[model samples]
Target: MQTTDPQGSVPSDVPEPPPHADEPRKLEARLTDADRVYRAVVSSGAAATLLLITLIGVFLLIGAWPALKEAGFSFLTEKVWTPDGQPPRFGVAAMMFGTFVSAVVAMAITVPVAVCTSLFINEYAPRAVRRSLTSLVDLMAAIPSLIFAIWGLFFLVPALAPIEDWVVAQFGGWLPLAEASATGGSLFNAGLIVACMTIPITTSIIREVLAQAPRHECEGALALGGTRWGMITSVVLPFGKGGIIGGSMLGLGRALGETLAATLILSIAFEIKPRILENGGITVASGIAIEFRDAKEMGLSALMAAGLALFIVTFAINFLAAMVVSRSRSGAST
Candidate 1:
């Protein structure tokens, strides 16, 4: 008989070994050529922005070099500005002081109103009302600076004169701004005008940024039984701090470069006074705008130097804003 196995199973060829437990892991590839090109393009665009800023600085410096070399460092500290006589003495102290004081006054006036308006829009107003009000603010922003100057000169100045007189009567003895407005135009007037000019921009930007704050963070604050003010102060502000700073800086930049409005409203005298309502002070931009028509040769160069100084200040403010934004982003990521 054939001796066949009871279980007539076919024999297996072999058993495969299991995958190794300690094999080196492979990583996904980083990027393709197209992706690299795209990244390079983006980087180049960013570099181009910096390059443009550098070029502007270089151009400004080149244009102002004659005055800069002639005046040396004393140009910054000197208070008198002649610009017409022989050798044409030009000092930036009065202009610089005027610029800073007007800007400060504008910021002081703008910050409170802008912040409050933004808060009301974000937290208090109905959706319909908020939309309408926001549109109005945007419209205000579209109004030309020259128009604002005209309004300030023709309308606001007259309207504010009585108020100015009241202020002078109230504090004239203690402060110089109250020393009587010889022509009804003062640094205070310019500052108030600038405040009006900056309000729409600051309020709109701040409202938009505050609106972008993390909803969940605000909700969490509410859930913790926090009042609306408490939630805003603790959560919303901290979250939107960077944007607030950016908006303020943007307003400051506007204030620094404002020419027509301040020039129209300010007295443009060379006298530098500590009083906000003083009549004699003038800003760099206003100085340039007012005198550029008459300026020639050395006078033109000196005015350009003033312009360069304003440019540097505005650039520095914007740079600080960028750095703040970057740091805020980094902190958020962590």
Candidate 2:
């Protein structure tokens, strides 16, 4: 039975609930003066960066307007870039083709080597040697583009000429791509140089992503009697798939924009050449660099138009890469 208190209310053993049981706890951070200042500074910096990018795009558009107005849709379709001719019959089709082909070739070479190097460095190397290897890759990334161009022109081209000739001779009959002359200044050699330039940055990004793969998942795979290669295949590779794509796209963008190396290594041709092994091809960036020095009024505008095209392509590539990364497991911040 229940007992009554002095006021005749029934009493039980249960204690009264605390004052506001249903009210949610406030989780908001208390901002200090320093915190507020830091937030404001960071916000301004981000805004500034966006604004700067917008300004650059606006400038490119303004500068390219005259050429685009004159050339109309033909700017993209026509291959001949005789800007010096009356009415300026210029277009980016051939240069764009060369850019894509060389970039594709570079990616084909870069991706495998980068993945293997990253995996070996992250999963197989001794901890003592890992840092050194990583630093070496970073150093390679820091090397100037001009130096790579000079090296390709003087040494790499000569070294690759014999190999190029042999490959062409072996496969030329069966493969149209291999039917062209295997000269020193071909897109093939330029692609090789671009591949070397791309490898370091790609390896660095992939290595970091692979290193971030869930440790427990990897161990679980190994515990399930999986071999090292099997564990990596099942765990690390899946986790880093987005990063690999992102790195490859980034490398492709770099290859497309690489001016000095392409300019130095390629003998520029205005016509579309599907055969990358040929001695002459021109990328958009290389064309711009080569033509800029002697360009007059309309020619300069035409070059700006070309620059606009390249800028759009690179911007799209990077934006796509960012989207892929943001949707990937490795991109999660916490």
Candidate 3:
């Protein structure tokens, strides 16, 4: 047996161990001051945003308090809105109904087409075609709201006349919607115009969200011999459902606040009724637009109350969207 030295077993060139096991922790400790500054900046930004929203809500409430106190809760339920005489009174029921109906109709039209268009752009269209279409959609989106209003007034409204006429001729006896005349502007026209207005926004948001779908999921579906449609319906759509709902709600919110085009297109009456074809219906925004010039002092406050109502509606929608997004992130993490 050969004698082996312990010193020979260890390499002479071996380096000493690192100073401490928690060296990384020490380095991080040194960064505490910088981390504190960063956290302060983030907290300040969040506080600023909260402050701004709070100020807005407070201002709206202050402006609306007189009308709200006088009318009580019946302001929401009452149909009459005359503010000119003694003991001035106003109500938002008709405006509320019109706003809801038009928004609903717009969403009904926009959601399907937008989702389909986004799906096609994301999964079906060739890359070159998708690029071109996406550019066109973006261009359409960038067009000013006023321009859309003008174009709808001149072009789309007229173009829709024949289609409206045909629908009335074919379905008039069966449905109340079909009773609407082709020439005059109506709820159907305003709803359709709003739908058109929202199409680009909805399509763009849905496309971006769907494009962010997990690549591996899609690949796995394809590998499993799933058809393109089947893969989209099952994998892509389920993944994007939350985003889609959020986008739809945002679009609906836009429709609710739309003023110029809706005012120009929809026949505005103060009374509430169900006939979409009826000569008069006015959304809250449009009502404000139409009546603001002639409104007296209390009437002005009444309009502000409606504006406050719209603001609350939109804020609620955004809050709901945030909740949906949070839930989606949690589900994805799990």
Candidate with the larger lDDT of 1 and 2: 2
The digit string of per-residue lDDT tens for model 1 on 182-227 reads 5367777788889888999999998988888778878989999999
Model 3: per-residue lDDT, tens digit, 227-325?
Answer: 999889778888888878877877887888988777888766777766675456888999999889999888888888998998998888888888977
Worst 10 residues of 1 by lDDT: 9-18
* Residue 218 local lDDT, model 1: 83
**Quick one: ranking by TM-score, best first?**
2, 3, 1
Backbone clashes, each candidate:
0, 0, 0
Candidate-wise lDDT, in order: 0.83, 0.87, 0.81
Clashing residue pairs found in predicted model 1: none
Please provide the root mean square deviation of candidate 2 (C-alpha atoms, Å).
8.1
Roughly what TM-score does model 2 have, to 2 decimal places?
Answer: 0.88
Model 2 stretches with alpha carbons more than 4 Å out: 1-32, 331-334
Q: Which of candidates 2 and 3 reaches a greater lDDT?
A: 2
